[model samples]
Target: AQSVTQLDSQVPVFEEAPVELRCNYSSSVSVYLFWYVQYPNQGLQLLLKYLSGSTLVESINGFEAEFNKSQTSFHLRKPSVHISDTAEYFCAVTSKTSYDTVIFGPGTSLSVIP
Candidate 1:
């Protein structure tokens, strides 16, 4: 079985500052990691994922996450954040056996302050 865990429930950052959202997971076998963002009143959007190949993955919008198999962690980071970046972020994990089902973390609410 695989499970995801988000270290923070809420994260507040000033505009134009760097931020990092921590995520950890537990699995006996190899797993695929993902990060998703949800804007207000909108569906969850895929931010980035590490399905295969390189352990590092990035999104078009400047979000990056590295999959550390040894640590069992996939932490998301951004160099600079904007107010529009504020949203709910979720970390998820899935294995080959349970590809249809993705286990998501509690979620971290990111608030950008001006």
Candidate 2:
């Protein structure tokens, strides 16, 4: 079985500031890592992924995260953010055996203030 947990339910920061959204997971076997961002009433888009190479992965937009095996964690971080970045973020994982379904965390809502 696989499960994901997001440490922070919400994060509020001023525009141009840095932010971090914590995520942790537990799984019985190997899995794929993914971070998806969802805008208002829109579907989620793949931010980044760590399949099986370097421990660190980055999204096209300046967001990055690291996959830690020992700690069993994957936390997202951004050096700077804009109001447009404000949205709901989710950390998800899919097992090698079960690629059909994705397990998602409760999700973290990022609020960027102007």
Best candidate per lDDT, number? 1
* Pairs in steric clash, model 1: none
Residues 8-114, candidate 2: write the lDDT tens digits: 99999999999989999999898898999999999999999989989999988999999999999999999999999999999999887844589999999999999
- Backbone clash count, each prediction separately: 0, 0
Worst 10-residue lDDT window, candidate 2: 93-102
The runs of at least 3 residues in candidate 1 whose Cα sits more than 4 Å from the true structure, single-residue gaps closed, are: 98-100
- Cα lDDT for residue 28, candidate 1: 87
lDDT of each: 0.95, 0.94
Q: Which parts of model 2 are misplaced by more than 4 Å?
A: 98-100
TM per candidate: 0.96, 0.95
For candidate 1, the 10 contiguous residues with the lowest summed lDDT are: 93-102
